[model samples]
Target: MKLPASGEGDVSPAVHHLVKGSAGGVTALFAHATGFHGRVWEPTARRLPGIDGHALDLRGHGDTVMPEGYDYPWAAFGDDILAAVDGLGRSGAGTGSGPVVGIGHSCGGAALVLAEAARPGTFAGLWLFEPAAFPPPAPGEVQHNPLVEPTKRRRPAFPDRSEALRNYTSKSPMDAFDPEVLAAYVEHGFTDEGDHVRLKCRPLDESQVYVSSLVANVYDAMAEVRCPVLLVQGAETPSGRFGKLTSQFPDARLEAHPDLSHFGPLTHPERIAASIRVWLEGLGTRI
Candidate 1:
């Protein structure tokens, strides 16, 4: 099947994506986690059979461009996913036998849950991979971590596009990816500035994004999701935190992989795809 162009323009100053799959069955819309672009799902998308797929670059990440001083909030991200879903429906991709599936990784998973909760039964099912749902740091317990909070609060300015790409690839957990994969990420993760290039995500903005996750609550929203939920977690991941609440969903099921890390989708896409295929088939949803 022809793979449709996956990136598009959004009205909210954010980047949108819609990857078409040739499966001619149910359509799946996937969102990537923080620090990664939507294309990370490409490997898994290629592995699923009989289904068309769509992946979006959430605001402030990947190809999505955000306005200056924009601190991405959890609610806005949720709205953006909904917009992507509506865009697909309008594009005539919503037709087929099965319900539309919303697949999300890390914080993207939380956004999906919130979107579904905002509108009950909006998706046929949900496939989430270790959504990063940490409890809010107690009143004064929040500490400073440079990894999560870079020294320069604003988006970094590199000497050139190549330098920007180097900075991104050097710091990414996805450095282990093939050269081509790494290139694809760098291509979407940076932008040219005059004669130089810089990361599109500002340091302070990203820090705010992380903190937003800590305080956001999707439990009530999860309860509202009427669709079946398939949670694929890294077994090595300790229990508690968000992992402990996996069982709360009405029809939720969990699958833990012993060797994968938080970045399983990038590190082990094939396995993630295989597991998703099995789960999708078991759901008996059309295409």
Candidate 2:
């Protein structure tokens, strides 16, 4: 689906998304991490029954069309999430009829926080994994994000999807991902060209996203979110300061997995799905 930047009363380039599952049940809106697309949630969505899932591609990622000369801003990512939820309501997908849950990872998790803060009551609850919701750097402080250069150095092309899959399965971070999730990433995260397939999210664009994260104040907006939140992170690989973040939210809990990593959602979909199910059950929401 294509939607406006801020959903309603706002206009900007179209945002692309994929929706599935039957309506009249819980509605789930999924936002992906930087350099990853919406379809990466397919594995987790499959485990979730009776949920209307809407997975969105943020600007400059996946199939979302990025306007020329517009560098990615973290705030705009929040707008894109709002637009995706609004699109669901317009499509009669039961956005209001049932609970709306925001499931996000890494930067996607930060976007969800920004969205709910920007528009209170947009999400009934939020399930985030290692959300990159860092406090903004001090004024005039030199910001140094360690991930920027590595992101800029990412390989953007492969001889074929098979080669891409092989390389990722053998590589460091992606090698830790679930096979099915990695398959979905290999299939939907790239576009076919004459002789090769190129990653839809350019290395430079992804690097810009990291650079923008340095200035993002998503942590400050945490207090604006009034809904219950479940923050999940790998004990072995905590991304941000969860203790401080939990204190900022009105009602929130943090869970750490000893064996999981920052990519826990992708690396262990079943475990993540079980956690989501248990949390929803605790909230008295039907599966």
Using TM-score, give the best candidate's number: 2
Q: Estimate the overall C-alpha local distance difference test score of candidate 2.
A: 0.82
Looking at candidate 2, the ten consecutive residues that score lowest on lDDT are 8-17
Note the Cα lDDT for every prediction shown. Answer: 0.70, 0.82
Q: What value does the lDDT take at residue 91 in candidate 2?
A: 64
In candidate 2, stretches whose alpha carbon ends up further than 4 angstroms from where it belongs are 4-23, 94-96, 136-142, 236-240, 285-287
Clashing pairs in 2: none
Each prediction's RMSD over C-alphas, in Å, is 4.5, 2.9
Q: Which 10-residue window in model 1 sums to the lowest lDDT? A: 1-10
Q: TM-score, each model?
A: 0.82, 0.90
Tens digit per residue, CA lDDT, model 1, 73-112:
6867787778777766655655455578888898789889
Model 1 CA lDDT for position 269 = 73
